[model samples]
Target: MGENSSPPDPVRSFSRLAVIVQLMMLAVVSAGWAISDGTAVAAAGTATAATAAVASVTTPPMGWASWNTFAAQINYNVIKAQTDAMVSSGMKDAGYQYVNIDEGWWQGTRDSAGNITVDTAEWPGGMKAIADYIHSKGLKAGIYTDAGRDGCGYYYPTGRPAAPGSGSEGHYDQDFLQFSRWGFDFVKVDWCGGNAEGLNSRNAYQAISDAITRASAQTGRPMVLSVCNWGNQSPWDWAPSMSTMWRTSGDIIYWGQSASMDRVLANFDSAQHPAAQSPGHYNDPDMLIVGMTGFSAAQNRTHMSLWALSGAPLLAGNKLTDMSADTKAILTNREVLAIDQDPLGGQGVKVAEDQTGRQVYSKVLSGTGRRAVLLLNRTTSAASITARWSDLGLTGSATVRNPWTGTDAGTFSGGYTTTVPAREAVLLTVTSGGGTSSPSPTPTPTPTASGTGAIRGVGSGRCLDVSGSSQANGAQAQIWDCNGQANQQWTSTASGELRVYGGKCLDVNNAGTADGTSVIIWDCNGQANQQWRLNSDGTITAVGANKCLDVPNNATANGTKLAIWSCNGGSNQRWTRS
Candidate 1:
């Protein structure tokens, strides 16, 4: 009996079949999306020509950068060592692609004709040689530069002396073109010099973006642009059109030290502009500080889970050449990584928080009624936390699986409850919540109507009014005292615009789709950006971007501006029409 096999178990066979079917469905759906966009996708399977050059960018980038650990001490030998270790240490196979040489790689050196030059001493075989080496290892190469005339190597200068004009201030096009010519696949433009010179963030980054575009065109290779302005000027509001990712906050950990949990939480909070994120665009929370010296194993787990939940770029900042087995295991956990790289590109939001420092967070996954839940306990004592189905927009019972330990935690009705250890977290994926889910508590189809009414905010108890009651085309929408005025009156038109003043439609300023895009009144032109849908969930959604009308920071003050953000079931997004 030990060596002989009986008939296959029906349950096991069914489970295997289900897995296969799910994988097939995913491949089919993903491919359809990419093909519809006229782009090549790996899931398409047959378009080997287009698929190879332009794989669908549906997730935040995952890679390793040198700044947090090696800082300005990096050189040709240093990069080679890390690049080799990235492959040998299993990081390369784990979807860690870019080996970024952040800052310090170059000093202010330009030859005749205003060309940026890398010192042969530091970059021995030239910058292109290292890029070729990284590509040889089947990974992408990332280079760094400052927006103005100085960089960290010139100001903060770690292990190197200050070198004037170490940035790309006067050479945006030339510098980016040089990076592309040298085979760099990514570029992180820092704001050190820009800030020093009081340069306008928008103007400066826009120039860099344009330069990168020109470079990509010239080289026939697109480079991922990382706008590293540290969230100043709220890059989430406009950077999506220019860069793949923008830093939402300052560095999680300094160049040479371990990061604190508070810093992690702060950075996480800063990057929660969920409305701004989409496929190929992300709000960066700086690089990962996992496995660093200061954090304990539990803390490390929490850090990873939070970042993964936020759909942040999973850039490793630890020295890969020497990592403990535990660190490697935590870093290489595929289940957690899958959440970070979910194809849907949804950001997790805080659904509930308590007095004892406990919180429940939820993220809507790709499949029906599937959700990712995080039970975080920030208190010093262990606490039992519950994830409510109502809060998650889920109904009835659901199956829960712990991604960290790879085990099913059974099913429960209404919600799931578990005791999270102090200062740690529990990450579980909930699926197949019994019955159906509604975007709201009661399912009501958005009816087509010509009726006019004053729209009030559920959270702020204020009326949505045109700022200053201005009739100008770009007048901003804001929450003000409820008054039966024409400015507060809105008609939900059949064509989807919430029209006021008869001819002006609520528009996304300049038809912007990024997070924090202002909600304003503009001349009705029947554009998708001006279209609105009054949903059953009590939220007004911008049809084109599929974002909700939201009060910035949930402010209850009068004159609080309104914007469109990714719907997160927040009261700030709920509105009432009467």
Candidate 2:
């Protein structure tokens, strides 16, 4: 075998943000608390600013991590074995990259220059060799480290190990740079013991993120930086610009483990619902323990389905050397995996949540032709979960196919239902009829005395006002006279595209597909680039650009340049229903 073809060495241990406190904080501090002095008030204001100021950038990562199943028992050889299985088993071809080895791979001491190194005992040929193996197989290698000195002691959270380098930026930066040198493509930085001891846990997390971003720039390799802060401050709000994926929760374990599938489901709910996550950055609910000792193949299938539908990262935390054919099949399901790795990078949102406790996550996948929905049974008993055509907001007729079973879900009139096993999941792949496009029913333009049909603000009263115009293909959609133009009418279609009246489609102005780009109305060319959806929170996101439509200058002025910007819920980006 060639030098780069050598198998990686073997065993080690490993370890691994968001919401609510923010609202309470704003209410209590800004509205309730009053600082008596100017200096004190300024300090309070500054502290109120969060580190994760950006909106959710990427959808959750969709691949595997090693912590949940192997824990500290992971080794270099194990990563090699898993990467091989991932390829031979068809996972890499299906887009499951990021073969991350969690904790224990790092040495307890740094070099005199403050560079972190891999333990030679566990990784004899060095992380570079392991990375070579992974890359040779067409995959990415991820490493584990801590933002704090002594590694944050997260290896055993409750029984802190007194990690010597706990909360050390110098050490953290050194480790990141070293990983970059070793050809590592991803980093999962932990914050266990450092959470309580940092000058401010939030600031400390930001500091590490800044360090990683700098390292990524310095090394000239685009590494995925994942901050595992366990939802202390709202990572959804702050970490998107710095990292690719950040853990929204501590870790998810099933089959009598510390964290159960229930915890995983809850985290999924939080990420999809009122809170939003998007591409470039993701809401990592931790690694997958599916196909591990405790869960059945069916349960694991459901686990994988939910994560994929939610765009959560797919990290397999099982013993790969002993994986069964059924387990391998579940992990490498391409149709299901497509939902997770969809290029659009739009995170699925929760459309239904009932007290009977079932949840549905619907995502818009590629092909300009399909939709993916994961229906999960949160309860321990079997329950019937249905997807109605109306509920999905489909304009005309459609078909739902089971991606997992490879069978037509059997069309009913409006929707379809299947009994989901307790804690299990089902995957639905929806496509429009006959591959032909259908025009949604355009509302009749309600004209005023002036005869100008202007529709203002979509959804909330924030809409465009039109005066005296008929809907046409190239008609100028100006800031109207505000009588509600049906041409100004829009709907979030089942395909997840925000289709407008007439045949035009929403687009990112100039087609500059970068994070934080703005949006505009463009000719519909049946291309994914023209599709867009206004997220429930009123942020407008375009499909082709993979970014949110932003109001430039934060200006609400008429003809304000609508550009594609990152999906942060700022007043500049947040839209209201007209």
Candidate 3:
């Protein structure tokens, strides 16, 4: 055979060897790519792997949302324009990053494979394309869905019939995956359909949260879940664990309008739930109506100031494309944003209110002795509002800086007083002297106990003890052995506060009316939940919810927890003074 074709075809064998090596290299690259993709997914999914995810936002997100302006008029084009406007108008540089499409972006039906689809007519380029455009502008994209079968704007006239699969009720996992696939960085889960479906607020929010976590795990994308239940269920009690921010009031209509004050006041009241505000989870008071025409420049400043001081999400709802100079200035104030973005994450509180409709709100800022104070004039005419340092837990003099004016308002000791125009606010940062200081002590509880002694649980024969003798707020009040400890000693105050553990008052957690809601000691906020009336019949009753303090299960165990329950006149509900 001619020596087997010259022993060997060296050239052909070399070519074959080269092809084999290339194939091996390609396989190795493919494996590496797969591993890299898997690692990215793992990191993104880790934020939501557990039922209760740690907060993703260290500060409330500053952004622009479509609901307050466009409502159901949102579409791919509108969002794209807003994204472009955000960049071109200097808002992006001012820290406004999110461009959220509020509602009406879904098709009326899911695909045969049970996948949610966008309204092709409205979003001709599709949500993914819109998200890509937003990302190109270095901004995040957000979308809206209802927790139930329909979103709040599901029936809004968007020139199309309402979508059948518009919400995330039975399709939470599917919708979450679809949103993640579309590159949505945020989701505002509204409650209209869910509330209509008779789902409990807590359970419904938790389910969607778990589904989002799973979807994030699968898609390798982190999504901010905003709970939009309109504060109907006191979401502050449970939404913190599940959502980045929860709406604490109904929609804010127009800025500085007479009727909008109700929404603002409702939010301010809801923000009083201090337990709900944290680094990752914020109490949303709804979108900012800052640039709207109805409000004056001063009023707009007030709106921005309050939102910032309260640690509420500052999602500007105005048209970014044509914002006026004054509006831009109000929205872009860096110093005010610093207070809202403070790491302390404390929600500003209504510390003082006067008969003239003047109110003072205060929040402790990040640094020691640094506080943000707001003097609000809610009246029809201009009035002088005062902020007492002691009311804000500050004793010594503080250098007051007007954040809006960018000027020092001089140092003040006892308090600061300023004239705020009607329906306006003065925002100030009070920086205390660097010396070591302490707040004026809380007023000692006056002994007003009619019975003047230990409150003994009649059936258990144990004393009501502050769990662990902890003086911290929200410490559970429970029955314990009669140790004659300070925690077990109780004195009923004239103001109806069950003063125990020094200044802490016996409180019904969240003013819960339900059976088995924990009884804890909280700061006396003069809320009805902290008020109690000692009945002549030897039973103690919560003043507002009208529930009696009863030991859970009527058990006589030493550590049985005390809760507020219906007044059935049970022996366990009775309290006797020793």
Candidate 4:
């Protein structure tokens, strides 16, 4: 990856294969590559092309902004320092491609010629030098502007505003042209449509979008258009056609700074839908507020995971040079970031709500066999949520690998359940349970035992005992009498761990926890010995015992004894449909 001496448009020379290979290389560096065939390669190629087509101009914007630690009090010196830091920090090699000047860059008045100019006192060498310096670093420059007629600043931060005869106009096309002339590679146009004095606000956004597209083509520099109208408008539905990414949530104000955790969670919750967003057009959940106002490592990890899972841009609002090691670790976690940058580009959905009101977001990764499940606990109390194997379409058992700990939670059946502390998140990658499906076998005889007596319940309280044991986790179980015992109670946890009401999952008892270890419910902790597979034929088999439920020699008699024996797929190992 060396600089080109040729005069070719370095950006235009980026070919499909080159970009895909680069992305594949990055995936190999960050995420492990799955064994992919032509179909998967084609799918990845298409996704990469879409991403490159819309995102090629400004792939990973890596410039400094004033919003993170310094809000509006930023001057040109700070911008220069950030630009210098981007080069010195080796971030350029990591693909931070843009140095954007957020807000505060504008002054009240234009030049005597009535054209917008950089503030001389603030920007001494003018914007052209800054742009040159950025380009010299193999990166691009970005700037911000408002869409309204009049910028709210008293000095008119963005000139005289778009008022009816203020010598200034609020035309998106004109503004876009002006920005293009400034050599900007990215534009974050905001303050449009939501204001009270704006004219035809809804149409104004669309107008700006049209103007951006037209201007980018005119400049021949392909500027990345970031629509910043907030999530008030469903950007997912409308903004995709306009820009590369639109803000899908209200402005992110930093951890423990602006709003409460509840507000943040609610904002992201409402924005999840229309799971069709791919590489180019993305649903932005606003900027990263991590590492700002002194956020902890754990909090930042939570922020990164949730944002990545939502397919939001990884734009860091915090000052990069002033970051801590812990903060860097959280931000640089490749495993968590891959979930967000996956080729599928699908937004994570709220799978379940916890008792403390936390949420679990499940995002299926690029491959059909993998998933990134984020357990986010937003409340002040420790909360736990369960993802069932059946609910996630997983079969039998899976290896739940926690990304943060870099450790495997062992192969588990049902689903993987983890407890997250308040205001924290747990991100895991789950390899599919191998028992997703079983091979079809020869049909066996259906049981038909004529009995005048009713079937007795086995589990606690009112359980149905269709004359036999219904001893499987996913098995279609019925009600029966309590018998004041572990066999009477059934535990139906969503994570695929089923136990008798007040007992653990029926164990082979020690796991000999012994043969003839009557199926007794025990604590529903995840252990291979306790897990039972509910076969399609209504037979229950213990994973460790390697035995299936034997209906005592396939007797077609009422109240046949249920016992576990080595798996032979015999008639005795099957049960009749209830």
Using TM-score, give the best candidate's number: 1
In order of listing, the candidates' clash counts read 1, 87, 3, 34
Those runs of model 1 whose alpha carbons end farther than 4 Å from true positions after fitting are 1-56, 354-356, 433-436, 439-578
Q: Could you tell me the TM-score of candidate 3?
A: 0.68
> What ranking emerges by lDDT with the best candidate at the front?
1, 3, 2, 4
* Worst 10 contiguous positions by lDDT, candidate 4: 1-10
Q: Estimate the Cα RMSD of every predicted model relative to the unseen true structure.
A: 14.3, 20.5, 20.6, 19.6
| lDDT by candidate, in order shown | 0.75, 0.55, 0.70, 0.52
lDDT tens digits by residue: candidate 2, 153-244: 43353222434553355565666677788898777777754554443445776677666566667877756677777644445555553556
TM-score of each: 0.69, 0.62, 0.68, 0.61
Q: What would you estimate as the lDDT of candidate 3?
A: 0.70
TM-score (C-alpha) between model 4 and the true structure: 0.61
Off by over 4 Å in 4: 1-64, 87-95, 112-114, 152-171, 192-194, 254-260, 354-358, 433-578
- Put down candidate 4 lDDT per residue, 1-578, tens digits, no spaces: 00000011111112222223332333442232244531112222122322222244322233445554555456667877777766665555444567887765664356565566766787877776777777776777887766665443432223223222111235567667777767777777665323425343346666776676677677766667776655432444556555677665445563226433433443354344333244455666566766666456677777777777676667777777777777666666667766766765555654444342455556656654576778776546887767655444446678888787778889887777778888778888877846333222323322211111122312221332322333234332233442423233232222223333222244445565244455443333345555555454545566556676454454544443345677666755654322
At residue 256, candidate 1 shows an lDDT of: 57
Task: Please provide, for model 1 over 181-232, each residue's C-alpha lDDT reduced to its tens digit, 9 standing for 90 to 100.
Answer: 9999988999888867878787998898888777777888788888898765
